[model samples]
Target: MALAQRRPPGLKAVVNVAGGLISAIAWRRAWMRSSRPSRHWPWKDTLPQLWVYAGNDDLFPPSLVDGMRAAALDRGGDVRLIALPDVSPRGHAILQNGRARFVWLREMDTSLRA
Candidate 1:
C-alpha cells in the first residue's frame, strides 16, 4: 500500500523478494478478487509486481512462485519472477548476503522508477 501510494495516480508496481507462503496466499487472494467483477476491489488501480526468489528456497519454492506469477498474469495483473541459482537453507532470506541484499535494492529501485 505504501508503494502504491508513492506511485503516480494510475501506476502501481511492487517488488516481492524471498517471500514465504503467507505472501503467496495474499497474492492469490488479490488475483482471485481481480478475476471476480462482482467482488469489491479496494484498489483504484491494479499493481504490476515482480517476484524474486532463490531457486532452491524450501519455504516458497520457485515452482510456487511461478504458479502465482502465471495466475496473476492471467488475471491481467502485471507480474514477473526471477529465480536466483542456489540451493541453500536461506529459503526465506532475501538479505542473506551483500549481493543478495543488493539484488533486492536494485529490484526496488527499478520498480519505483518504472
Candidate 2:
C-alpha cells in the first residue's frame, strides 16, 4: 500500500498481502479507527489494487479485512480483496509460504491480465 500510494510513474497494479491500516492490538481493543487513516491505506483510485489476506490470519482477521475493503470502496478507491485458505503455521506469512506462493501468484496474474 505504501508503494502504491507513492503513485510512481507507470505504476499499473498493486498486490497487498496481510496488510491493513489498524494494528492487531488496536483492532482487538475495538479501535479500528483509533487514529486518522494512515497515508498507506487506500485514499484514491490511482491504479488497480489487489488485497490478499489469509483466512486464518490472527492479526488482521476477516472482520478487519472486510472493514478495510469497505473503507477503501467508500473512499472511491479501486481495490479487490482475495481471501485465501488457511496458510500453515501463520497465515500472515503467506508470502514466505512456498506452497501458497503459486496460489497468490496465479490470482495476481489473472487479475492483472484482465
Number of the top-ranking candidate, with lDDT as the measure: 2
Candidate 1 residue-wise lDDT, 1-114, digit = tens: 345435666554676677543445555456456755323222343576777888777767676666665655555666667677663447566566567767667877777777
Model 1 scores worst on lDDT over the 10 consecutive residues at 36-45
lDDT string, candidate 2, 58-104, tens digits: 87878777766665665677778888889998999888888788988
Each prediction's TM-score versus the true structure: 0.63, 0.75
* Candidate-wise lDDT, in order: 0.61, 0.73
For model 1, give the RMSD to the true fold.
5.5
Residue 57 in candidate 2, Cα distance off native in Å:
1.5
> Which 10-residue window in model 2 sums to the lowest lDDT?
33-42
Model 2, position 64: C-alpha lDDT score: 73
